[model samples]
Target: MSTYEASLASAAAFMERHERFLVINHVNPDGDATGSLLGTGWLLRQLGKQAVLVNEGSTPEKFGFLPGAEQIINASRAEKPEFDAVITCDCADFARIGDVKEWLPLGMPLLNIDHHPTNDLFGTDNLVRTDAAATAEVLYDLLTYMKQPIPQEMAVCLYTGLLTDTGGFRYSNTTPHVMEMASALLACGVEPAPIAERMLETITKAHVRLLQRALQTLVLRDTDQTAYLTITAADMEQCGAQNDDTEGLVNYARNIEGVEVGILYKEVASDKVKVSLRSRSIVDVAAIAQSIGGGGHVRAAGCTVHGTLADAKQIVEQKVSAALASQEASV
Candidate 1:
């Protein structure tokens, strides 16, 4: 009846055509990425298809409660396996697929299913819906159309994706339709408390130390409307925090009132910094990410910049400030 409805139908059509699937998401898979992979894996298996969840690194410990979480394989740990098709969920481009990008089945059908507007359309069948709140939203419609019953475990995974990507339904992307979809998942026995606990409450001691150290280094700009924190190798070792510990720290800056932009810079290696950007409103962080050779949604996005953390933080803050100022001028 509408464009999205037709698109949902097509996604269903694509699933029906495939018998075997290998699911991959972006590097350092977050709740949305991991949840999308798990939910899709469950749905595919329900249809008598073999679905293997593959990623560049280990699944975040926060998502261990999700269905099929243990089945997720590290592309670097074992030899890559061939599949009839490769499906990428929640990743905007091939580069974001990280180390596993090398193993992508060449000349085979690839499905790029996502909600980010900056998606590179790497899949033979590109199903990018920028209007949707989350990739999980797209999956919900497709699963319903395919007549696949959503089980409680699958519901937990989908709900985690929906919640985190939507900022616990507090972001601008949270629409009535998103709420309705979440309600449906809840009806399928998705409990908010434990899922929230698993996804939010489960934090490591190193993560807490990292958060403290990171906050100590925070710098504010744009008259305190923008805040950023940088983590160096020394900082990581001092706190005993790994790459995964850096999750959700950006929100600390974003949550401050009057702050329009928040940034977290993690020194992945010497002279290499991973920059994550977030905005409440009046800023399109994704555009900033694109300019710096990465892409994601408007409210939350990231890019890896080559240089010292200081260099990357300065560039990213300036870019985000310009975007925020431009939005202000327009108003």
Candidate 2:
């Protein structure tokens, strides 16, 4: 196993050796994934490498304001292009890259950059740093090591990554180094108020209606210490909302008073449902997610259950209830 530092050196070397790169991020990208993907693109361009940035799905509309976001191609529409290597950011496993994998040439070298501890280390060179607040933090170190300067556009991407992963710097992962990185990015001319407003404060009318529909389905379980919200296809279609509109809906349940666990169940199909898990205290939501074939940080994680919404709810509620009963669920 390559040490994180060793992988950093190797990843940088791989970037240097490659003249063209396919850069991607996880499916259903959040700010961290989108920012890291674009930030990596900017970084590669700084090294004079040609980077074709792709995402397994569309980036959230809120992130469209960031520099270079317009260039992100969805996998379904992306055509195969020759490249020296494939670099994925903020993805814990190869599966997270989704359909983008289909575009890669066989035996392509991969530089896996991420901050998830659950990362399978699937890259030829892995730079997984669990201590870092976000993947952008890892990129910041790489930029510093390469003696590269952070430009204004790059600052927007990196700063957005740090901001989102830390829940606007309110999550437990927000550390001193994360703060310093944000400070440096701010120094690079990242306007704090506008980005924060667009990212954290803004929501579309369609999303508001979506939220209205979701809240009506909200149910409090586990003696009101857990909150459950469901979003069905009917609601989505009626509201004219896309997956991006559902971005932070799970947080609504998670922020409720006395709610230690919040779970959102969204219908993916008649027989498939997507689950988002969040915790307010000691629960290891990531473990709960991984138990059912998904992964993410402890406070926030997600999984997909192959069943109707009711069936998925039954499974998730049981698991979350069990975890809450466990010692880890206690404050």
Candidate 3:
């Protein structure tokens, strides 16, 4: 059997062997992260397995439309349940799961279902397929292998994952297999237009103001091949914006003409900055992120650095500039 087939079989066996499970994703849960966590939980429930969906952070209001999102409890709110296994979706590293790490049973089997190229392979039974486009895609394959019927609710959740991770099928990772899975989910009674509208088109006034502030800091570097933006804590305070409001602001930088890479630096703490990276064509932002203790896919990645916003920006800009130079030289 192929590697993916073998991994699926192992994952299915692991799930079957366990009774109670704790499903988790990254801290700042996005559509893909939230969708995968909820989707996997719903699937396990269909199999009569007890699954508790937990996150270190709360679900954003934008994803309230998802079927099982309301059921997801924050890690702080969750009781210490007797969990037989732990499954993480979309999170590339254990640290991304935040406080949920402390809640897992010691030495319990972990099923790492993810698509990030920078995955740390931290699970006992890893089903990390970097080519899958989204962790929800990996879950869909696992469900099919286990002969579980995809319910409408699961379909909606998985479709949301595929839709958001691929930027609504606009990103380069939107492969034919991704489209096939999306089509299958659609056949399971998911409406794409509504999901797209809810995820992409609906933006709050605070988000608009945050975008405005971010755009004001947009800077072109590396001879205009790189575009970067910033969002200080002051900007968030002035606009009444939370981290959720800055979700897609990095795209504005990436969409600039002649720019191959985009970067967003957000001051998350007084002495720390969170950096999001996106690349258009050749630059592998994932490698750059991994080098600095972060992980993600080729086109999109992120990492946090300890320093002032100015210091973080200078460090990241130098790294990105070197990566660009290396790519150009190799070409």
TM-score of each model, paired residue for residue: 0.94, 0.96, 0.98
TM-score of 2: 0.96
Q: What is the lDDT of residue 181 in candidate 2?
A: 88
CA shift at 261, candidate 2, in angstroms? Answer: 0.4
- Write down the lDDT of every candidate, Cα atoms only: 0.85, 0.89, 0.90
- The alpha-carbon deviation from the true structure for residue 46 of candidate 3, after best TM-score superposition, in angstroms, is 1.7
Task: Give the top-scoring candidate (TM-score).
Answer: 3
Off by over 4 Å in 2: 328-331
- In model 2, residue pairs whose N, Cα or C atoms come closer than 3 Å (at least 3 residues apart or on different chains), thus clashing, are none
Residue 267, candidate 2: Cα error in Å is 0.3
Q: Is candidate 1 or candidate 3 better by TM-score?
A: 3
Q: Candidate 3 overall Cα lDDT vs. reference?
A: 0.90
Task: Estimate, for each residue in 40-159, the C-alpha lDDT of model 3 and write its tens digit.
Answer: 898788778999898887889999999988999987876777788999999898899998888876778999999888888999889999888899899899988888888899999999
The TM-score of candidate 1 is 0.94
TM-score ranking, high to low: 3, 2, 1
Candidate 2 lDDT for residue 56:
80
Q: Write the per-residue lDDT of candidate 2 for residues 118-209, one digit (tens) a residue.
A: 78888888888988999999999888877889999999989988988887999999888988888999999999999888888888898899
RMSD of each: 1.7, 1.8, 1.1
- Candidate 1 backbone collisions, by pair: none
